[model samples]
Structure formats: structure tokens, C-alpha cells
Target: MAWKVLIVDDEPGIREVLKDYIEMNFEHTKIETAENADTALKKVTEDQYHIILLDIVMPGLDAFEFLRRVKDLNSLIQVIMITGNSTMERVLESIEAGADDYLLKPFSTKEIEEILKCSFARIERWRNAFRNSF
Candidate 1:
């Protein structure tokens, strides 16, 4: 099965770029986009996703707040914070709030692809461990 990704960004261009890039390069993955945190939250609640590419700053309920809420809703969901503002504080906060990884804005498509690959590998390892425990 293809891994699913949810992308939350206020900018339509960014969302489109990510969606197109992922679709073009990654045959084993699919991506969905939401323009805001609220909509993203609703979608996440309705469907399971392998990874979430979330922007740090939005019109309302910024990525940090969304990350916290997502963790509260589903601990297994892996969130990868994406931001133009790459501050140490934001990175640390994202980690504290349970983001699995953080990517800076204007990052190369190759970087994003690498991160997704690592995320999938990590999830596979986790699944294996969980199955073994049963």
C-alpha cells in the first residue's frame, strides 16, 4: 500500500508544489492538502496518514498548536514541521510537541523525498516491533 501524507499550508502554491513533486517522484506515496489547521485537523481525524507536512505559521492555530492537538488525538501520527522560519526555538518546540521531524522552507525536493523515505522506514520498524509484541 502507498504511504499517505497530509500537507497543511496556507499558501496554495506551496501545497500544490509539494503535492506535484511528491506525486511525480514517489510512486509509493500519496498526498492530500489542507489550507488551514482546522481543516487539516478534521481530515486527520477522518483518515489515517503516514506523515503530515505542516507549516509552522498559519492564519489561526499555528503549527505548534496543531501539532499539540494532533498528538493528543493520535500519538502514532508522524508530523513533520515545515516552516520558512527556521529558529532553534521553533525546532525545539516542535520536537517537544511531538513532531517526528522538521524541515525548513525552500528545501530541495530531494530533501523532502529523503525525509519521507526515512519516515516510512521508521514506521515500518515500529510496525514490526508492534507485531512482534503481540
Candidate 2:
């Protein structure tokens, strides 16, 4: 299966590294980038992504608020919130904002692999349910 992914962050280097790492490690996956929450919102609305790596800090639009708005735009996408800060407050906030998972900025490769595995498994389950229903 070809999985579609989106990486949203204000830092170019973060986006580049994430894109490279995910691409190199994951097969049959296409990844897109958005520099800001505004662009992320637009992309999420116009496209379908199985997983979204979203930053907690962004200029112009607050990431938390963006996550909140995302619920209305599309709830099916598995959004994994990424942040430099690993405070319990932020984790709670991310959960409240509907993030499927939360990862620190310097997360290990294994962590991402696990996140992807779980997210894809969820997609597979949904697909199986739909196919069985029909």
C-alpha cells in the first residue's frame, strides 16, 4: 500500500530531515511538507494523508489551534504531534486537540516506526471493516 504522509513544521531543516528519514525507512510512502499551520490546513483539506507529523510550535497560526480546527476539516487522518518541549501540559493539550500520538523533537527511529505501524494497522482495520460490510 502506498501511504500518504504530511510533515508540517516551521523549520526547514526539521522538515527535510523528517522527510528524508521517513522516506529512507518506509517503503511505498509519499511525503509532503508544509511550513506553517496555514499551509498544513490547506493541504489537509485538499488531500488525504494516512499520517501527519505536525509541529507544536508554528508562526502565524498556533499549532494547538490548528489541531482543533483540523477536527472539523478531517478527523480520519492520524496526526502525530511533534514538539521540542516534552511537558505534561503540552501532552495533555495535544490529546485534547485530537492528536493520535505525540513525539518529542529528538524522537528515536524506533518510535516513528512504531507510530507508523500502529497508524497503518488502524487503516487496515477500517478497510477490513468496510470490505466486510459490503
Against the true structure, what is each candidate's TM-score? Answer: 0.95, 0.92
User: What are the Cα lDDT values of the candidates?
Assistant: 0.90, 0.89
Candidate number of the best lDDT: 1
Model 2: pairs clashing at backbone N, Cα or C within 3 Å: none
Question: Across residues 46-131, which tens digit of lDDT does each residue of candidate 2 receive?
Answer: 88888889999889889888888887776767889999988999999899889999989788888988998898888889889989
Candidate 1 achieves a global lDDT of: 0.90
Runs off by more than 4 Å, candidate 2: none
- Candidate 1, residue 23: CA error in Å? 0.8
